[model samples]
Target: VQPVLEDLDPALEEAAQSLGGSDWTIFTKVILPLLTPALLAGLSLSFARSLGEFGAIIFIAGNQPMSTEITALLIFIRLEEYDYQAAAAIASVLLLAAFTMLAVTNWLQSRALRYTVKG
Candidate 1:
């Protein structure tokens, strides 16, 4: 988010202003599109982090085996029970989910910025 914000081309707004764009027009037409990728990336990363945070969640929602189980907690339980297959499956699902989110985030970002040349 910081990099995107810091590296944003001031010329975008300047050009809009020179062309008689209003403040709302410049922000909605120029700045918003540039910031979309950053916002999506942040959301994807935050969700991934929260998904893997089993320890913090465990304290809040006791370690009941069946309900309210986060993927990490479920994997831990399966491991303790020596259910290697189940543990592996659960871990794979979690990994796949995180990977999908990150991949989609990157793809969306690139697609959104496709017309932009590096400044």
Candidate 2:
């Protein structure tokens, strides 16, 4: 994210300001549009990371059966109980969800790129 922000041309903001744009306007019209790809990338990576944060969540939230159950923990519990079919099904669902999220991210990134300034 730092690299992405650094890569953006400072002159773009200066130009916007010279054109009588306010700080908010320069950010929204110039900076924000240029940072779209970085924002989307960060969002996607964080989402994927969050999905796999089973250990942290388990330690912090504790496995409270139905009350505070997470899919990953549920899959592990099913496996421990020798329910291979249930564990496999739950794992499959998680994989599908992750793939779906990636697909949507890619689509949005492509659309955003179309509006980005091409050098």
TM-scores for all candidates? 0.77, 0.89
Q: What's the lDDT for all of these models?
A: 0.86, 0.87
Tens-digit per-residue lDDT, 4-73, candidate 1: 8899888888999999999999888888888888898789979978986988889999887778788888
Candidate 1 has what TM-score?
A: 0.77
Candidate 2 lDDT by residue in tens digits, 37-103: 8888999989988877788888889879788888888988999999999999999999999999889
At residue 19, candidate 2 shows an lDDT of 95
RMSD of each: 2.4, 1.4
The model with the greatest TM-score is 2
Candidate 2: 10-residue stretch with minimal lDDT: 110-119
Model 2 score (lDDT)? 0.87
Error of 1 at 93 (Å): 1.4
What residue runs in model 1 are displaced by over 4 Å at the alpha carbon?
Answer: 7-11, 17-24
